[model samples]
Target chain A: MSTIGEYIASHAEMLEAALIQSLPPQWNVPVSLRESMNYSLMAGGKRLRPILVLAAAEALGGSQAAALPAALAIEMVHTYSLVHDDLPAMDNDDYRRGKLTNHKVYGEAMAILAGDALLTHAFYSITQCHKVHGIPAERVLSITEELAAYAGARGMVGGQAADMLGEQGLTKLEELEYIHLHKTSDLIVFSLRAGAHIAGATTAQLAALTDFGNAIGLAFQIQDDILDIIGDEKKLGKPVKSDEKQQKVTYPYFIGLEASELKVKELTEQAKKALLQGGFANPERLLQLADYLMQRDH
Target chain B: MSTIGEYIASHAEMLEAALIQSLPPQWNVPVSLRESMNYSLMAGGKRLRPILVLAAAEALGGSQAAALPAALAIEMVHTYSLVHDDLPAMDNDDYRRGKLTNHKVYGEAMAILAGDALLTHAFYSITQCHKVHGIPAERVLSITEELAAYAGARGMVGGQAADMLGEQGLTKLEELEYIHLHKTSDLIVFSLRAGAHIAGATTAQLAALTDFGNAIGLAFQIQDDILDIIGDEKKLGKPVKSDEKQQKVTYPYFIGLEASELKVKELTEQAKKALLQGGFANPERLLQLADYLMQRDH
Candidate 1:
């Protein structure tokens, strides 16, 4: 593709097809359960995490077909997190992406189970990397372990727990960074690493990608906070400044908006530097992706 | 170890220690998240599933050291299910095993995240089969896939969904059986198969154990239904006839108490016969455990 947008568009098509094909057959799952899972999985988002998986793999000379399952798996994990986070017990969001949230559409019970089913099935989907896509079992095992570590108690869930606890009155900058680093960055890191592992990247290369992912993940979050404060309301969808309305502590809350923007630039530059030094055959797309994320308004 | 009770006592102690040790160190996990998980995990159940993993491995001449991680993993999955099942939007229970339910103590949000953390960590725990316990990578992969299958949409979650939908008024025996088979039997079957895979049991032996697991799982459910009606309240740790009080359609509700008891006996016999024909090196403990389950009043 000539542009990052084109690259995302084409890869998203394939990712959508792969996601549908990857679901267990209707006969195998309960009708309502399958419906609830599909409602969330098919809900439109940026599709950034899975696309990162595909781009990272392609950049490392891995075939898209080989990385497709991991791509879908990461998206499933993301979808499950969203589903749970939108529950009445959590953020209690009624809508996401202009549609009813999972718990709002389905009852809380089914939504809870659907989120769970999605989480568990994500691992099952990853196993297909070995079972169907000809990836080595050891590589698949490593990917599975990486996913569990990044998504489990000490990673995304821990970040969420900390964030929730922080919401009660804590205002430390370190705690906010911890939450952002884990709740947002860990899965992004996992996506890149999973794809790189599929391509048999060396330790040095994986470390480089980890640096790239961490930098861009933080940049992405900071940019999101900046947009929430200053971006066009219509383009962004929903209202801007919702964070300020809720008195939520964000990057801009601790640091001024100009500083937050400068930090995003610094992190994006750091990410590009890591990729340039990693000696990959095709880092162009990943470089473009980091820029696309940094500059996007929505 | 001469009796099933003694065998269970010793195995329970070992399983308890393993469960605690298998947890990510306190420093690695968030304090409150760890506390929520530990609360439910240590609240105590029969520890039946993990013990079964140990016993099955022993039957096939595999060491307990090799099976312990898988044992810990299955119990984590079981504990997570209970934590979510007790949520206000689900069963709405305030207590379990004489302790406050997870949501009751930690609040609904933490309870949900804690359950999510436990479920994710279960897969992480299973990966230790190869990492710490020296089981083959391929075996660990298989065990992980089996866990996702038996616990995911097509298995326990599917069963829970069906049971919830059925409570709207459907009372067919077939539907009830479908719910019980998937919800109860799948995990039991996975427990046996995980141990068998660790032991390097042949496909035939795995199939035989599956049959044994299915028979006992259903029989065990029936026994639960029967006990809910005809057993002592104090021994059972809850009121007797609670299912009847709720008008829940259980085995005895549909088949009559006499037929349900008869079905339990026949299923137990079938389970024993499968073990006898399976050519395990030692089936003594599993056999005694089955009979012990059959004869238990509480």
Candidate 2:
């Protein structure tokens, strides 16, 4: 059987083409706005959230075509968040993935607009499930509601706010956990849930996926923190010790590096266990993907 | 037999209460983000868009209770746009409706997060129509789609971008009209259409309202220009001629003051005519609301 890396490599190319096709016509989008939005979106990444969406759907016996729009929508939301976070008033990062950030290439104003446009267009993309794949309107609406819940004030945005606020003071273990849960895990959870909803997963199956998503999401973020200390700069596409330079609180700050690594392994096991219990037609890909994420050094 | 003034005052109070009631609990939203969002939302204005939603629903024999969530959603969208527009990277305004702008009160970072949170939460609010009013999933999904279309990159955001770009060069009357049509009329049209959709308006009826919305939306904006040059400062709650100070292109800039005033009257007449042609259980309130908007100094 092919490894998860082979699966990801094949699917990522499909996603890249689908994203370009999904953009509204030039007449619909203004010339400069379209250019700015495309600039950041076309910049490549791991496509992790969207890949999770496809994997979950496939595990539940759904077609990838049926899940493509939702996968695209979630990616747009993720991209928009990154764009906004890199703004001068926010994280103010000059680079992402070894490339100049959205605001660096486009002006701050256009970057802000590009982010807003991407976020808004994400919902528009979700609606395409009905047109493109014949997903029921009821199911689409449910997905839309859940997406807004996870992406909005009470979800990722709230977490970013908490993280920013935490920057001014000492962040306790519990507060850091809260930030990680909302800022990272919430969207991850939504990605899984959206894909499962498209596949008509039962409530119990959805619960299992949620648990699996939460565990892996936290593990993924912890891995990010651990990588900051010991990761290769060329592989990471940015310098190591960024959290240290910023004096940012991290898992490694609270727990020792070895303990943090242990936590990631433990969470990965928990995630795999949840998936095994999920009773899917095929969970091998997801199980392997979880292991793959944990084993990655970058 | 009461005047439109009384109609506005009575409905405005109900809208104010509903807006406050619609906010998510403190636990769901971070403290600073909530404060920044509420700061701009509660800064009172005429409540024209939400009221139009109610008016259109009523005209088609629908209950206000059934349309409140959508009304609230549109208002949130409008308020979020104002917040983002007031950012230092954008319009850089210090005040809105005579109160400190969101960024002025909350730091720039929180203000940006607040705007993002608010924009996202608007979709969450729209979903409430299913829970609060028992609107069907299909209808709600359609409303959600239309809302995204009008408020998204190709809609209001596109208009804002065009307006910004127009600042660099001489703006012809056609370009100015394009800006006003999308920037102002699109949301107004959506507001009316949303209410009509909730009320089960026919295709013809929706078309009539769209026409009416476009005419009055332009007229309303032109009135803004006229007021900038000739309006009372206290009534407007801000300095007059600020548009002139910015050297912004306005209707009066292209057509001259006397012609601009005549244009408002002409468009107002056309709007009233469209409403008269629209078949509805009751159109008196909407008809009067249109006139009220035309006659307002602020």
Which parts of model 2 are misplaced by more than 4 Å?
A: none
Flag clash pairs in model 1: none
Model 1: per-residue Cα lDDT at residue B89: 93
TM-score of each: 0.98, 0.98
Mind giving the per-residue lDDT tens digits that candidate 2 earns over B1-298? 7788888888889988888767766557777888888888889998899889999999999978989999988899899889888899999999877888998888898988888888888888888888668888777887888888888888898888888878875558998988888789989999999999888888899999999999999999999889989998889888888888899888998989999999999999999899888888899998998888788884
Off by over 4 Å in 1: none
Q: What is the TM-score of chain B alone in each candidate?
A: 0.97, 0.97
TM-score of the first chain alone, every candidate: 0.97, 0.98
Q: What DockQ do the predictions score, one after another?
A: 0.86, 0.79
Listed per model in order, the count of residue pairs whose N, CA or C atoms clash below 3 Å is 0, 0
Tens digits of per-residue lDDT, candidate 1, B102-162, equal 9999999999999999999899988888988888888899999999999999999999999
Real contacts retained, model 2: 0.75
A13 in model 2: Cα distance from truth in Å? 1.3
Pairs that collide, model 2:
none
